[model samples]
Each structure stands twice: as structure tokens, then as C-alpha cells.
Target: MAPLLICDNRAEVERERFVPGTPEFRRASLALFIASFLTFANIYITQPLLPLLVDEFDITPAVSSLTVSLTIFALGFALLIFGPVSDAVGRRPVMFWTMALAVLPALLAPLVSSINQLLLIRIAQGLLLAGLPSVAMAYLGEEFSPRALGLAVGLYISGNSIGGMSGRVISGMVAEAYSWRASFLVMGIIGLVGVILFYLLLPPSAHFKPAPAGLRKGLQDIGEHLRNGSLLKAYSIAFVIMFSFVGIFNYITFRLSGPPYNLSPAAVGWLFLTYSAGTISSTVSGRFIDLAGNRVAVILGVLIALGGVLITLLPALWAIVLGLLFFCFGFFAVHAAASAWANRQARRARASAMGLYLLFYYVGGSFGSTGLGFLWHARGWPGVTAGIIFMLALGLLLGLTLRDKD
Candidate 1:
């Protein structure tokens, strides 16, 4: 038997075989985007609510953040399991089951009367959600045309930004108006709807070949990816960039609510609209990366984000918002470049590589956000800004160091 090969140019492969913009491809991409958005939204819903949770649970700022931290931790770790499982099983079935499982926890979360229970459910939710991202990337690698893959991936990421923004905005407002429990219920319903749409629309993979399942093979694949210098640099870039991004947001509410700013919850909710800038930047940057290459685009993105952080130092409220918009724009641009670079660098087991990248990404969010909460607690916004600046510097270094081998 001939060794099966996953083609890099999915568009040409499909054109030689299947019709372009066929009902199947359109449905699959749309369904996957919806599901991706819902999963990501649920993961980030707690971000804007950290202050509320601190007051409600009567916990320290760091502890209160565990509601989000633990979820990302579980998500980061679960990628190891999900990546290989999708390779051994198949993308559609794994995605369907994982997404269905995710809905249950969101519903169950509102029923939990205690913070501990909520935390437990969130961990379970993170583990299940992990199945989607890694498998989704692998699906694109196997199914899309190389020329078109960048756009498809960018759209999926745009769904992530939209979901993240919606989750924070809606949850913050609902928590202010009703109770936090209501926020959970609303997201739960959204998850259920996403699941239905995903089932109805996601087309079956025509090109996937299941790997032979064994622990040794899985470990070897993972080790091979880790050994690649460029891939390792991409992973580090993801870690530092996400760490800086989440750390800033984790404490921004605390700053606004307490001091000279003293903004209301609804007012704070409006602030997350800055994420819209991220959605636009990701799409534009994706096209830019294809044209200019990852190194230049990523370096420019880091500088933009670093400048945005400096804007927050201004005492004026409008300046702060402007700063946030720039920060989000830079973050998304850098993220789009780095993620695409990872996909292109891995010659085989691309799903595992992407999963590893996300593991570092979210773990950076978890630890960086929680650990930096203390900086805000001790020295206020200055301390938090200083921490983020350090991360951005490291990210810039990594971006500059990136090299492609022909």
C-alpha cells in the first residue's frame, strides 16, 4: 500500500476532485466557525466578570481569577489528548461529541450554588472545548487549498474574537442587570444552538487518514515538533503575546472600578468593544502575512501593541480607550501571523503542533493573568503595565528571530 500524504494545497486537490464553493464546503466552514465562536466565547466569558466574581465569592483577586485560570489550564493540557485522538479517530465525530459535551457544562454551571462547583464545571468545559481547536486546524490542513487556507483560518479566528467579545459584553451586562447565573444560562443556550448548526453543516473529511494509535507514536510525533527551532519560536511567541494580552485585561476592570475612573459595570462592558478592532486586524493581517511574510508583519504588530500599552498610562479616559484599541489591533495582527507560521512550519502532525501552540497560549493567559493580578493589587495600573511591557519585549525578540527554511 502507498503511504498516504496530506496535501499542502487543499484548493488544487479539491478542484481536481470536488467542485468549488460546493454546498458541502460552505456548510462545513460556516458550521465550524459557529462552533468555534461559541466554544471560545464560553472560555472567555469570565474575563470581564472577574471583579464581580471577586465580590460575590469574597475571594482574593488572584483566587477569583481561578474561575478563568483553571479553565485555560485544563484547555492547555487537554490539547495533548485531543490532537492525537482526532488523528486516530476522525475530525467530524470528535468535533460533534466534544461540542455536544461542552453545552452540558454551560447548562450545569448555572445550577452550581458554590464557586468550587463552578470552577470544577469550567475545568470540564475547558477539557471538552480543547477538542475543537486542534481538530479544526487539522481539518483545514487536510481539506483546504494552500492558497485559501490562510483566509479560512483567519475567518475561524474572527469567529473567536466575536465570540470572546460577545461573551464578555453580554455576560457583564446580564450580571449587572440580573444575576451572574443568568449569564451562564444565556451562553448555554447559545452553545446548544451552535451544536445544532455544527451537526447540520460540517461536511465529512474527504482527505483525512487515521493514524495508527499508540502511545509511543504520539510521544514521538510531539517530540519531533518540539525539536523544530522555528516551531519552538512560534510557540514562545504565542505564549508571551497571549500572556501580555490577558494580563492587561485581567486587571483593567479593577483599575477602572476603583480609582479616579470609577466606571460602572455597564460602562466597563462597553470597553470590550475594543475587541472589534481585533477582528478587523486579524483579517487584514492574514492577507498582509501572505503578501509580506510573517517576520515583518509580526514585528510591526508587536510595536503597535507595545505603543497601545503606553497609551493606557494617560490619565484621560478617551486616551485609555484609544490605547486599548491599538493594543487589540496589534495583538490580533501578531496572533494571525504567528498561528499561520506554525501551520506552515510543521511538515506532519500539524494538529499536534497547533494544539501545543494553544496550550502555551492559554497557559500564558492563566498564569500571567493570575500572577499579575498581584501587581495591580500592590501598585495599581503601573505595576500591571510594567509586567505587560516585559512580555511584549520578549515577543518582539522572538518575532525578529523567526526564520523560514526552504
Candidate 2:
């Protein structure tokens, strides 16, 4: 028997979702896109600064990496709380306050006298970062007409690509010219601007019905989704993709900033322009996914990503950048396809399924960004690359094992 979809109003929930080319649809998409932009930008802006942090704080490369890792780790747990809370209260209120409150910590980050104090602020910022991603998907699920959803989602994801690239470029440049503290200040300003625009643009939720806000109910709901074999595969895929991607980006900066390459921080930041390749690949991959089937796309993406990892092992700067471009391309493609696959398997339980996917995603990233530091310390960049490739291979194998009916 199929599980029931809980909602406050059946008629409202069952109504045809939003269609493309409408004014209201644009507003919703733009708002969500901006939300994605701010969250990703702020969270990852620290990537290029890892080397700078080691010098400033007199910390080891591994310890300096925690700024990104800890931020991502907090985001995972926060998703568990906000997903159910948004179900009960409302999406806009939760999203709005999360964005607003997150800004304060960013603003305060520059004021922190100790590294621990900065980490505390990052934790709070990461927690609030949760309000958008899962809820935004839920919002799109309710609001978009099925035919228009792909484009709507594409736009939202585009923001993430551009935001991540711009954040690193801007922060790294600012840190180079001034100080790393100034980089945080710039990121905080950008975040503030994003919140204002999001508040003014987003439409109120009409189909959103408050589910009962209870921890027990949310846990039970998540448990039910976990029982589905296909859903579990979707989750494991997410875990590996994020784990491999974060670990690579975290250490690449360290490698490039060292001896032979001797790149400046801004130069390291420029390399992230490869993320735009992801933006392009994600869009193109989406078109092929409906025809090629999700599994085929996922397997190819993992293989492509792994190939990129291998290219980075070469001793050429241009080759490294080219590798990263391919890596980002594969990352975005598989993510778009795999996420859609998971939601399809979950059927009516879309929100909970998304929450689980995100939970795995960040948990993977947190560990990837932090845990791989030991390998980096022991065996250099080659060790980190070996670890990431192993994870990618596992993900590819899991992708192959997924049956349509599972």
C-alpha cells in the first residue's frame, strides 16, 4: 500500500502547480535563486582563504580547513530541524528570518578576536543556511506546474553556480588586497543585499499547508522514506558526490598555493570560474536526463568527475584548471539528475525525501572537507585525490545498481 500524503488542504495541494512565463513564477524563482546564491556564496567563500588562514592564525592546513568543514557540518543538522518546522509554520517566514538572522553573524564575524569565536559564528550561520534549500524545493513542488519545474529548478541552481564562483573570486581578491577579515565583511554585505531583494520579490505561499510540528512525526516520516531501496541509493549517491567534491576543492587550494605553482590567492580564486562549466553542464544534462534515463546520466557524471580528478594529478597549471572545469561539470550534472531521481522515487513524500538527500549531501561535504585533511597531512595532494576517486568509484557503482522499479 502507498503511504498517505499529509496536507492541511487536499484541494489546494492537489491543484495544478505553477506554469512557466508567468510574473508570479518569475518572482518565486528569482527569490529562490537569490536564496541559493547567498547561502552558497557565504558558506564557501572561505575556500580560497584556507592558505591565508594558516598564515594568519598560525594553524596547520588541516586546522584551517575547519572553517569550511564546520560550517557545512552545522548545515546538515539544521536541515533536520527546519524541514519539519517549515512544514508546520510557513516557508516564507522561516526563509526570511533564517536569511536575516544569518546576516548578523556574518557581520559579527569580522569582530571575532579568536578563531573559536569565529567558528561559533560559522556554526550559527550554517544552521540558518538550512532554511532555503529543502524548503525551496518544497515550495517549487507546490507552486510550479510539472512542465515548468525543470526550468524553475534550473534557474535556482544557476544562482548557486554563479554565487560560489563570485564569492571565492571576490573574497580572495579582497583578502589579497586587504585582509581576510575584509573578505568576511564583503560577503556579509552581499548577503544583506540578497535578503532585501528576496523579501521584496517572493510571493506568499498559497498551497503550503502546515504539517504538525513534532520531532517524533518528522523522524517517523524520514524513517519511512529510508525503507525504500531506491531512495537509499539516491542518498548514498548524494553523499559520495559531495564528499568527493568538497575534499578536492578544500585541498586543491593548498596544493596550488605551494612551491611549484606558487599562485596568488586571487589566482587560486580565478580557478573557480570553472563552476560556470557546471552551470552549462547542468542545463544540458537536464535535457538529456528525461530521454536517457537518470541512471545513465549519473554513471556518466561520476566517470567524468573521476576523469577530472585524474587530470589534476598532472603537473601543469592549465591542466589543473581544465580538470576542475570537468570536475564541476560532472558534479552539477549528477547532482541535478540524482536529486530528481530521488524525488521521483519518494513520490508524494517529496519534502522528506529532499531533506534526507540534503542531510546526506552536507554530511558528506563536512566530512569530505574536514576528514580528508589527515590524508593530506600524511601523503600530500595525491592522497586526497586517491580518497576522492575511491568515493567517486563507489558512487558510480551504486548508480549502476539502481533499478527503475526499485
TM-scores, in order shown? 0.94, 0.94
CA lDDT scores, all candidates in order:
0.84, 0.85
Candidate maximizing lDDT? 2
CA deviation > 4 Å runs, candidate 1: 1-25
Residue 268, candidate 2: how far off, in angstroms?
1.1
For candidate 2, lDDT tens digit of each residue in 1-406?
2234345354354454566667888788889888988999898988999998888778888888889989988998888888888888888898899998888888888888777888898898899988887677777777776556556666776777888888899988998999888998988998999999999999998878777879798988898888988889989999999999889999999899999988999988888899998888777776767667788889889999999999999998989999999999998888877776776677654676688889999999999998899999899989999999999999999999977555
| Candidate 2 local distance difference test against the native | 0.85
Q: In candidate 1, what are the lDDT values of residues 316-344, reduced to their tens digit? A: 98999999999999998888888888989
Clash pairs detected, candidate 2:
17-145, 18-143, 18-144, 18-145
Q: How many Å off is the CA of 159 in candidate 1?
A: 0.9
Residue pairs with colliding backbones in model 1 are: 10-144, 10-145, 11-145
Model 1 poorest 10 in a row by lDDT: 1-10
